[model samples]
Target chain A: MDRVAVIGASMTKFGQRESWVMDLLAEAGEACLDDAGVAPDEVEHLYVSNMASGEFEGQTGIMNALAHDLDAMPAYSQRVDQTSSSGGAGIYAAWQSVASGASEMTLLVGGEKMTHQTTGEATDVIASITHPVEYKHGVTLPSFAGLTARHYLERYDAPRESLAKVAVKNHRNGLDNPHAQFRKEVDVETVMESPIVADPLRLYDFCPITDGSAALMFCPESVAEQYTDDYAVVTGVAGATDTQVVHEREDPTVMGGVVDSGEQAFEMAGLEPEDVDVAELHDMFTILEFLQMEGLGFAEPGRAWERVEAGETEMDGELPINTSGGLKSKGHPLGASGVAQGYEIYAQLVGEAGDRQVDADVGLACNVGGFGNCVITTIMEAAE
Target chain B: MDRVAVIGASMTKFGQRESWVMDLLAEAGEACLDDAGVAPDEVEHLYVSNMASGEFEGQTGIMNALAHDLDAMPAYSQRVDQTSSSGGAGIYAAWQSVASGASEMTLLVGGEKMTHQTTGEATDVIASITHPVEYKHGVTLPSFAGLTARHYLERYDAPRESLAKVAVKNHRNGLDNPHAQFRKEVDVETVMESPIVADPLRLYDFCPITDGSAALMFCPESVAEQYTDDYAVVTGVAGATDTQVVHEREDPTVMGGVVDSGEQAFEMAGLEPEDVDVAELHDMFTILEFLQMEGLGFAEPGRAWERVEAGETEMDGELPINTSGGLKSKGHPLGASGVAQGYEIYAQLVGEAGDRQVDADVGLACNVGGFGNCVITTIMEAAE
Candidate 1:
């Protein structure tokens, strides 16, 4: 199999956007195309990830709209939606297509327009990310997160203060990320005092539903070599699923997909956990960060919270995770979260992540699509 | 690279359903496992496709729910969505994963539950498949199809009844399709007289918003070798994206991704258009059949309607298309439509299509996701 590389990547400042989804996608996509120094016409294929355009903006078939908006005539585009992990899946799909010699250059774009709908409407839109049976029984994402958080507390004997540490770390990191939505730093007290949406999962424990977009330019290793002397080589990519309905999982903490994806990705990259210098784990909910840290093999089982509370996941710590603020502080524009994770990793590995720069040669991104149903973990190295 | 083959496949009868999405997914998945003669324990990876649960059923993270339901602890599952073509893309993703040596045995499943919502509610749910900008302008699937149908009629100077011919052919073929949603015969007059949802596109011309599912089990040829003497070998798999917004295309009839997929699939298969004995084209709308025929290079530009009127694509005809009634008569449950298309081709290639079986050594399936945004086509042949 041929190696697929991320030659160029970009993201619009992740935040509440008054612009249309197409505009956000275009800005991000154009940034990627121009950054790669590739002419727009050189792009052979496009993938767009938008989770709930119809409810948020009453729009659909967004790929075509973006193409027309971007003047990418005759170029192909597809929209990928696996909720929050859509961006990661888009990259995975594009990588596979490029690896197979299907296209010379592929653009993976993800964004959402959440502000178009009122807060109540947007909340309802986000609620769709839950299991219908479980959701109909009044289970919101917060409620689900609460269950997971409760389980983690039960399993690991971790204090709620550990969860507060995650928010403090990511928010502090966000202060330096121009593309992050929430740049304001907060202390553990702020997180602990925030309104509780569900037991144990406070407002600060959840990522805000902000509108944003991120884009990545993918090419075969050969094409990538021509595109740039320095790039993020996708050494490994893997995606796995557990179940759509949360209740069906025998062990919610198992997060089988994340574990599987991480193992497979590490195998493909020919690297071990110790090789990763930086990490971007999906933190849609504060508890998700703890779960991912453990499931992704970065921390010992039930040990992520302990490590997090000790600032082991902070910028100066070993295995620094989510230096870009993560979904918790960077904003969770569902489809864009996963892709945004990639954008941050690429920046960090390329030494372009100015303030939050970690001395990193290898970076990994773990994003879960709609809970743990679809989880993808990709490992990238500084271009050889 | 490892070769991927279909070891098992099954689907729920397409139509309105009282069952929940999990129930439907479980039923279809269980049946697929049984058909493949493999236990759920034998599967290593899972991919589930569903377009909308939040709006239609207020569900999210369906994979997590289903994983618990299946009692396949430690096995991984992931959710994927690419509009109506989700199922096809899901299968393609699984195949690529297996080929890339990620997993030996993978299960791909897709389903939807729209009957739970009212027709108006369902319309809003289905309309999510359109471009967000266009959708806000009150655009719908039928409206989009109407525009395409008009363009086809004016561009090709084909009779309006030519549109009817597509439904007539598929419905006639559906009569022999036990799993078809509409298996009754209808004449051109009856189709022409059907109530118009959008001008020039009638109710009969549209695929119903369905609650159904289809599943396929994929394994490397090495592993599948032990399963059965005869199986459907995935000779070629290709996916490409087109403009998601309909109005953005320079020529709406010309699908870049569909054409690209066709080219790549044919090249990978070491075959040409003429080598296909039968095909299952994406006919989400009547005009889509004509466009896909042209896109697949099965017919000259603007001549698919003429070919259809000549009965060249009928069962036992020169090129049988949609012997499983395509999406028109076969219920289309967004994500399931693509996988269902793959299942049909698998059945046809293995000579298990029952009464609708065509004498063919090779079969093809073309599934389009959300208008023309993403398209995945696969060419298959029976194992020797």
Candidate 2:
């Protein structure tokens, strides 16, 4: 079987943008093609990872519209949606397209437009993914995070301040990300003093509802040389589901989907957590970072908070995490969040991350969706 | 490369059912697994082909919910949407899953629940896929079909009654399909005298707004024999996209996507149209049947009407088309329509179609999205 390579990547400014979802997708798609030095006509398949264009913009068929906008006529196009992990699913879909010889070149673009709607409206739309029984109880995603954060702090003998440290570290990293939604750095005092949204988790502890898009170009590894020398090969990629009802899981602090997907990915890549030099983990909420860290085997169960307190996950730390600011500071545009993680990893591998550059050869990204109802993990290596 | 096989198929009754979208999907999914005699735990991937669960039912993350409903926990789940051709795309995705060695067993369920909403509301949601320029002018899919029918009739010197005959023939075939939404046969006069919807096209010329679901189980050919001795192998499958703007095509009467996708599929199968003993065409509109016949090379350009007039596409004719009634009479549940087409083809290949049985070895199915904005074609053959 042939391996898939990421030859190019691009991301739109992750902020409250004026463009609609279609425009944002096209911008990232065109830029990604330009970055890869491939013409639009060369694309054989185009995939869009979007959770809801119809619900957000009253628009459907955005995938077909994007194919038209990119002038990639005749290329097969489809939409891949796994709620918030849609972007990660898009990467997996692109890899399958190449691995199955379905396409010689594939373009994956993921974006969401949500700033136009009120915060309440956006939350309601996102909350639709939760089980109706849970939703009827007025338990949205943030509430789940809050309850989990409170439990983790007490069970692990960790201080509430540890949660705040995650936001501070990601915000500091955002200062180096030009496309980040929040570039200004913040301290633990600032996060601790932030307004409360969901009890134990404050306002700064949650990622903002923003509008943005990200794109990547994929092809068979054998064709990577024809595109560019600066490319990354996807050594491992897998997705898994846990339970739709969040309460059904055996352990609330541990996401089964994350553990299953991560294990499968590592096994495919033939590498352990120690072999990864850089990483991007979905930080939709500060507590999620800790959960994913422990779930991905980066830290022992209930000990991830100690690693955060020790600055072991900073950009200069032994295992730098979220160098692109993650959903914490980069803003969570739903579908775009996961793809943006790929953008950051690809940039780091190609030595184009500018000030956020770290010593990295193998990088990993884990994207979570709907309180860990589903998750996708990807491992990429700098082309040999 | 290992060929993908269809080991099981199941579909719910096509009509206004009491179940919600999730319930409908689970019904077919469970039945499909039972048909294949495969355990839920054996499924490595689960894909749902749905155009609008969020828009229609205010529900999202159906893929995860389904995994939970069917006891298929931990199976990777994702939603595949290519407008109305989503079911066809699901087949392609399932095929890729097995061919790429990413999944040992895959289950795909395509469904929609739209009858709960008013016809106007359903039309509006479905119209969201058209170009704003065309949509603003009140151009829906039926309107496009009407316009194309008018042009086709004038350009080819064909009678308007020829379009009505398509509905008549499909309705007659539907009499044998126990699960079809409409089983009573209709004559050409009944169709021709129906209320006008869009000029030359009448109510009978269009498919209904249905609520239903369909499913199929897929695996590599090597393992298909272990599950079922009577299985159908996907000899070839491919998808293609045309201009999002319907009027932008060079020929108003010809569908570029249908032509491209069908050509690719037939080439991959190493067969020609004449070699196909049975077929299912997406007759979402009566005119669409004529267009697909020409587009798929079953008849010469502008001469498909002659084939319909001569009864060449009937069950006992040279080429049996829509033996399971096609979308025109089987009902169009948006996503479910395409998978139903596959269900029909599989039954015929395995000689389990009962009253609708036909002498067939090779079968073909063409699914079109929007006004030919995208199309997918699959060629299936009886396992040796």
Candidate 3:
């Protein structure tokens, strides 16, 4: 079977942006096309991964608007929505399009515009993805995070200071990523002392509401050879869903979706956790990083906090994670977060991450949606 | 290359229902799973085609809820949205999942809960798909239909009665469908005398806002053979998009998306328009039937009205269209409408349509989104 290759990638600054979703999508799409030296007319499939352009901006069918803006008229277009994992789902969709012979050149743009709405309104939209029975009573994602963090600390006897370290490390990484939202570094003291929104978690423990976009260009490996050799091949990609009702989980610490998707992706790549040299895990909340790390098999249950405290996931350490700062400081723009994760791995694989560069041959990205209601895991490698 | 085969299909009654979107989707999904004689655990991929559950019912993450409701745990799930063509887009996505070897079995459910909202609210949600520039000025889909109907009649010299005949014909066909929203036959006189909605068009000319769901089960030909002997193979499936700005179209009479997607699908099927034995056209409005017929190559430019007048499109005619009453008398549930179109064609090909079945070797369904801003055409054939 032929491999799907990502020949180009681009992303806008992951912070407050004045442009609407369509413009954000078009900006990244055009940059990706230019990066690959491919004409707009060559794109056979155009997919936009957007969660709630309708609810947020009163705009639907932005996929058509994007194709029109990019002069990719007559190209097949659709919107892939998997909540915050939309970008990872877009990658899987693009790979399917190329691998299935349905499209020769596929362009995937994932974006969202949310800063314009007040924080309360924006969080309300984000909260809507939770199970209605839970969300209707004001159980937002932050509440879930706080509850889960408290449980994890009690169950595993992990220190709260370890959670604060995640923020500090990611912020340090973000200082080097020009496109990140927060470019300034913070200390453990700062994150630990931040205003407490939820007990045991503070303002600095969560990703901020952001507006941005990201894109990737995909084609068959043979076709990608014509574009450039500095490309990354997505060796494995898979997604999975767990119970929608979060309370039903036998163990909240064990995200079933993450475990399943990660195992599937690694098996497809013919690799294991030990084989991955670099990684990017969803850090929507500081505690999520620990959960995903444990869920994806980087560490044993109740031991991920130990790894974080050991400096193993740092830039110069073994199996560096979130070299693009993850969502902690890089920003989480719902739909764009997962795509940006892919961009980080793609850049690391292609040796284009000048300042944030880390030695990497195999890379993985784990994107969690709606507190692990769904998750997608993708593994990429350098195309030789 | 192995073919992707649809082994089972089902749909709920297309009418006002008290169930929410999740219930409607699960109703169709469970029925489809049972029809295929497959256990929920066997479904590796589950897709939901929903346009605006959040905007309509303040519900999101429907795909996850559906997976949980159907007991299809750990299966990868995603939501596909292409406005009104969401179901067709879901079909394409499911096919890709199977053909790409991403899944051994895939289930797709397309649905929307709209009757709960007032017509003004429902239409407002639907109109969000149109370009903001036009919709901001109080221009909605019906306004476009009226203006286009007037232009089509004046430009092609087609009679207004020909449009009325569409409503008459579909209503007559709906009389035979047990699950149709409207089962009573109507005469051309009744349609002509209906209250004027958009100038030349009348109230009867538009499909009612409905609440319903439809589903299909797909797998590889090898896998499908183990499940069922009677099945339909999707020979060709393609989608395309035109300008988002409706006025920018070179000619309002020519639906570029319809023509392109139809041609692409036919070519992929190694067939032509003339080879199609039956079809289900998107008749969101009466005039759309004429435009689609002409766009799909059933008639020459400006001659679809003549074919309708000649009775060639009736159930007993040379190439029967809308045997499931299309979206006219059968009801249009936004996302479900396209899936229902596929269901009609699949039923006819598999000898299961009962009263509305036609002698079909090959069938096609054309789904239009946002006034032809995007379209999907799917061609299917009986699996021997």
On a 0 to 1 TM-score scale, where does candidate 1 land against the true structure? 0.90
For each candidate, the alpha-carbon lDDT, in order, equals 0.82, 0.94, 0.93
lDDT of 2 at A287: 98
TM-score of each: 0.90, 1.00, 0.99
Between candidates 1 and 2, the TM-score winner: 2
Q: Model 2's CAPRI class?
A: high
Model 3 error, position B56 (Å):
0.3
lDDT of 1 by residue, B64-121 (tens): 5666567653455556666677787787778766775656888888998887778898
| Candidate 2: stretches off by over 4 Å | none
Interface RMSD of 3: 0.6
Which candidate should be chosen as best, given DockQ against the real structure? 3
TM-score of 3: 0.99
Give the residue spans of candidate 1 off by over 4 A: A73-76, A116-121, A132-139, A143-162, A192-203, A242-258, A301-306, A369-374, B72-76, B116-120, B128-139, B143-163, B192-206, B241-258, B369-373
Q: Best candidate per lDDT, number?
A: 2
Number of backbone clashes in candidate 2: 0
lDDT of 2 by residue, A25-131 (tens): 99999999999999999999999999999999889998899999999989999999999999999999999999999999999999999999999999999999999
TM-score of chain B of 2: 0.99
Q: How accurate is candidate 1 locally (lDDT)?
A: 0.82
Task: Tell me which of candidates 2 and 3 scores higher on DockQ.
Answer: 3
Task: List, in the given order, the native-contact fraction of each candidate.
Answer: 0.41, 0.77, 0.88
